[model samples]
Target: MFFNRQEIKFMFDENKRLNSKVKEFAKKNFHPKNFLFFSDSGSGKTTIAEKLAEELAKRREICYKSNDSKFIDYTNQEVLVKQELIHNTWLLKELLNLCEKDICPMNCKGKTKIDVMTKYNIITAQDPFDDIFNFKKRIFDENPAYSKDKRIGLHRRFSKSKDYTHGYMFKVTNRYQSGKVDFQITCLKESDDSAGDINDFVNGRFDIKFAEETTLEEAKKRVYDDDFENLYKHKGDVFLKREVDMDHVLGGVICDVDTENHTFSVYNKYFDSEIPSTMIPPKDLNRLNERLRNKIINQFGPDHEITGTNKRT
Candidate 1:
């Protein structure tokens, strides 16, 4: 026997009630030791969490004295991973330097783009694609200004003060199981604003930053290299004037800028690698700035608009 529309609506409302009841039960009875919440969207999971917190407060004297709530909405987990990688960048920088040497072992008479070097098949002894993606290429990109001696200044690029704050605001866990300090570490960046209790690099208090919240499905999805290529391909018209779009784009674009070298590495989100680095050529710097100014004007239009142009001439 099929139910009428009235009955169906009743069932839907009743189902919601039952869901809330179940959620309440799960929240109160279950102890969160090493737990993870996995559920579909709009399933009252988050609502249940709020309700549970209310219930817990009602049951006991709840304290909210701590001022450590900060939120950073990572565009995706890859960006979070990039932040973690930056935290342990000393180790990565060393490995990447060796890879750079392998790519350009000796002084060349002329400049060599990384892509060109790849085509020549001379930089194939070791592939660091998996280790740090295209970090080596970005760090060692051929630029006439920097490559005059066939050597790039790692000091300029790897300046810790310039790259990161001395505050050590980020944290990663390193576990030792076999009597050896584990070099391979699992990184977790908290999206919650709860990690702001510590001091940041410049003797200032650390504040949490958020990008946007990711759904359970998105959090669980596997990120890949092709995804990044697709993102770049569809980067769309850059209207830097729009704060919302800038935030969205910045979430996806993770780069380590070497202002001295005029080069920066864009992290490959999908492949867990680095893309070949790029630079604004010194010669074209002025032209690039002019073009960007024109593009912004074209996109945003003139600041002043005629207010009283309704009268017909």
Candidate 2:
């Protein structure tokens, strides 16, 4: 194998146990709620979540929320709700809980008049990095041209002898007599304060900050080697039969509704392809309304495909 067999085996075994626990939790007769399963990169969190989504689908209409449309391509068992849906669902849950206690002003009973322009501060924990990484991953995976541009840019920026550039430390990992393109890695966050952005965010304010480092070679392999099949080994094949143009739907841009034509237009910077109103699928028209809602920075899933097209992460 060209990879670490031992690490892969460990991940597979741990994911099996994690999937069982997730399935059990999903099977319980609990309130309709949102569950977030998170882990470090290449740790099989998505692998386990995909399996759990299948097991949960047996009970209720499970929705797989992510920015990555590829996940939707691999599974028809769950509804694909983008990041907006996930946030709306979470907010709805909070409002419902407050309503049950008769403390919310926006309760269905309408005991009091709800006022607009109220500057209410809603503070929620946000995972901004994961979303960003995933969105970049999707683009790097799907658009070879964009990926090549990035790779070339990095090489140019770090052309000096073995050293660190910005936060990344580039080093030649192996050399061969055949004069093959020498394999190298760009490692980052070597120490607790290596990442200045992260350091600035949590420095002085927080005493503890956790970090993990992975080689560029391993990261790139994980991206290219990842397949939807490993996630659904026992579930069989899944085909997307919907007429929805996912490329437009999940391509990351908010659509503009043309009321006169009764259609929507989506733009893709990657292709410079603007989906004309006529090409828009009726099922995707709903996303036009979603754009009206205030955009939240800290959405549920790590910024997936949706963030790739959105105005901002």
User: Which candidate ranks first by lDDT, i.e. highest?
Assistant: 2
The parts of candidate 1 lying over 4 Å away from their true place are 1-78, 82-158, 162-175, 179-313
TM-score of each: 0.14, 0.17
Model 2: per-residue Cα lDDT at residue 258: 34
Instruction: Give each model's whole-structure lDDT.
Output: 0.22, 0.26
Off by over 4 Å in 2: 1-30, 59-61, 66-313
| Tens-digit lDDT string for candidate 1 (1-313) | 9999999999999999988876421111100100011222322223323332233222322221111112212121111111112112323233223222212122212433221010000011011222323333344323112222212222221112322211121111122111111011111122211211111211112111111243323322222333322221112211101011111111122123332332222111222232222211121112222443343234334331212321111
- For candidate 2, give the lDDT of residue 53: 38
Supply the TM-score for candidate 2.
0.17
Prediction-by-prediction clash tally: 19, 6
Candidate 2 has which clashing residue pairs, if any? 67-305, 68-305, 131-302, 131-303, 252-309, 252-310
Give me the candidate number with maximum TM-score: 2
